[model samples]
Target: MPATFLHRFVLSIGFLSLFHSAYSAAQHRSYLRLNELDFTHLPLDIIIQALISLFVIMYGVMNVAGDFKEIKASAELENKSWETFRNIPSFYTFSHRGKFLAFPHQTGNKKHN
Candidate 1:
């Protein structure tokens, strides 16, 4: 699914709604504090607005992010060539015990028996 103007618009709207609800909650708390009242819970309307906005944001994100590919190996390697799987130089190590075995006398680490 290609991301269209509508998707971006909806995402922006959702973020705006969420921020507005947060501001409203903060203002409500300040008002209660000024009146020496205990902070209980947020108003129903603010909570509802926040929940709706979350859903809207999720919907917008899902539509904007295109489809996901399959995780199967067959699907991943279907169009790949053998050259892609060839020896990668980054993984090759030149300094190892194998080199000493290939040239024992040159290494000057001979064992006396």
Candidate 2:
């Protein structure tokens, strides 16, 4: 089953507390006995490094998603600009009698009769 945010958070806290308690309890035991048991050992430096790496990776992923969204929006705007340009008549096209006309190319194809 997929774990939700709350589930993951609870699990993380629970595991950390459990390990803390176990390590604290082990300190009162004999040094030789503590060394014999491996479960109570907790290397905090590696855990901190892993957490930082995970945060950085997640941040990078979010940045990439935002970049793709911006690119999509720009492409849509460019398409609309092209459509508008195609629908507007150019003043450079004049009639046979030298009168300037401003009619879209699509509408100019229809006969008056």
Candidate 3:
């Protein structure tokens, strides 16, 4: 993912190809020449394999993106649920008549109905 790593990878591939070409040239190998190869005669399985690989990569990227979306949605729902719970008053703090107490005192400190 880092630019420097990508640059190194590209350079490595280029160097490897250059070395291979030089080695093949020095060997006088006529069969290893690229100019004599047919460009339009690829096998069916090669094309199928390439297509399947592309689909798999796309599926993986989309799967990760979908997971991020689901996580964000779940976090938002949790926040909203907590907010709703906090906005509602609990029974311990509820007001009755003109006073706010959990219950009347047993020592006759409060007037009973």
Name the candidate that leads on TM-score.
1
Candidate 2 lDDT, 1-113, residue by residue in tens: 34456555655555565565556545535564756754554456545544654665454444433444455657666657666766767645554653445453564567677
Query: Which parts of model 1 are misplaced by more than 4 Å?
Result: 71-74, 87-113
lDDT: the better of candidates 2 and 3: 2
Backbone clashes per model, in order? 0, 0, 0
RMSD of 2: 17.6
For model 3, the stretches where C-alpha displacement exceeds 4 angstroms are: 1-35, 67-113
60: Cα error in model 2, Å: 0.6
**Whole-structure CA lDDT of model 2:** 0.54
**Residue clash pairs of candidate 3:** none
Q: Highest lDDT among the candidates is held by which one?
A: 1
lDDT of 1: 0.90
Model 1 agreement with the true structure over 24-102: per-residue lDDT tens digits? 9999999999999999999999999999999999998888888978888699888888898795889988777886567
Against the unseen true structure, what C-alpha lDDT does each candidate score?
Answer: 0.90, 0.54, 0.50
Name the lDDT value of residue 1 in candidate 2.
31
Question: What count of clashes does model 1 give?
Answer: 0
Q: lDDT tens string, model 3, 1-113?
A: 22354444544554455455455444434443545754444355544544554555454444433444455657566757656765755545444565544575577467669
Residue 87, candidate 1: C-alpha displacement in angstroms: 5.7
